[model samples]
Target: MSLRRRIAAVAAGVLAAPLVSVALPSAPAFAHGYISSPPSRQAQCAAKTVSCGAIQWEPQSVEGPKGLRSCNGGVAHFAELNDNNKGWRVSNVGRTVTFNWVFTARHRTANYEYYVGGQRVANISGNNQQPPATVSHTVTLPSSGRQTVLAIWNIGDTANAFYSCVDVNAG
Candidate 1:
């Protein structure tokens, strides 16, 4: 009611705005998933096995516009995932390689696509509920050499897809 009291109340309300939001009961956080095994570039960073940029904080959220073929899910803040100079760790694989995807919040999956040197090596149907915490598929690459494996997880219900790049020296 008093002027000084009113001014204090206004200042308190302004200061408490952020805390109020922080204190509110919000919905559970559901994170998008990424490749963990044969660790994707972001995965490597997330594991702290490789030192790098922002992707290190959110390896499981490397999502971008739907149908994006590049790592970092075509997002710039995650651009480090697409950088070869990031000193990404590489794995050795035979012509046949098994890619393991780790999902935190599983969505109905449309399909899983695998690419090597821009060539589609495998197209597996995922027309079902999200797989387990880790879903793996063995794909046979056409050639053997050092290359990047681009894995795309297309959501069955939505238009977006998760992308991950695994660098490997193929034997």
Candidate 2:
């Protein structure tokens, strides 16, 4: 190759190397998951039962640091999920409610937890193993009336977890 052409080719490769490295790793950092059955807030957004922004396109991407209580996993764009007055539909159910989750990329799980009124009601251990594409847990409602259930999937291999909130009217 000519000297000028060889130098130009090497320069282009060097400039693009960092961009490729940075982009590839982030694709797997997103542990995609969310509660689907009973229609968690994101699920509602995906179904268009509720109007939303970017979350409507990715119902399973609500990931954040573990121990967060926010429905949007503290993601700024997903703040709509944290809005209590967003016209979210509430499911009518008996005391026993079954929460279901769907995952696009299943990670090793630490556990799955459920909260009602900011208090924990159920914690199903994942035994520090990867879960199936779908999982379910049944927990009895602690009180009657309209309630928001926060379901969290704690990933065993990472410090992040997936969060979802379901509105319900337990009779």
Candidate 3:
């Protein structure tokens, strides 16, 4: 190769190195975040009210067989609080309570929003800046009793969908 061509090639290689290094080889990209769920074990609601009991929440990947998969470069997981055989009945007086939904994401930014009973509650943008993990916000349940909680990715429209009931007795 000519001297000028050789120098130009070297410069191009140097410039492109960073881009190449950052590129992922074969993994599919998906948006990611956290989701909370009703406990796997059965339980009773709080004495007179339907409050969610003490929960050991954990982060996990969002995966499914069909359309329920995670978004680009992302994984989805759930936080589970069980009922302990206590049934959650909707409050007849229309009371309100606050619950928290925590989450994390992988590559790309984590833009997430929380919804309860079809109403928007909390939201966060640009959450995940580094790779292999990024923690977002805690979504609050605005009302009480058997509300369907949704964690939506505002960026790519992905979601960790779950239906959990909030009891009036849980503190």
TM-score winner, 1 or 2: 2
Colliding residue pairs in candidate 2: none
Root-mean-square deviation of Cα positions for candidate 1 versus the true structure, in angstroms: 6.0
What candidate 1 gets wrong by more than 4 Å, as runs, is: 1-29
Model 2, C-alpha of 125: deviation from truth (Å): 0.2
TM-score of each: 0.81, 0.84, 0.34
lDDT sort, best first: 2, 1, 3
lDDT of each: 0.84, 0.92, 0.39
Residue 127, model 3: Cα distance from true site in angstroms = 5.3
The C-alpha local distance difference test score for the whole of candidate 2 amounts to 0.92
Off by over 4 Å in 3: 1-33, 36-105, 131-136, 154-171
- Per-residue lDDT for 37-155 in model 2, tens only? 89999999999999999999899999899999989899999999999999999999888998889999999999999999899999999999999999888999899899999999999
Evaluate residue 3 in candidate 2 and report its C-alpha lDDT on the 0 to 100 scale: 100
TM-score of 2: 0.84
- Which prediction has more favorable lDDT, 1 or 3? 1
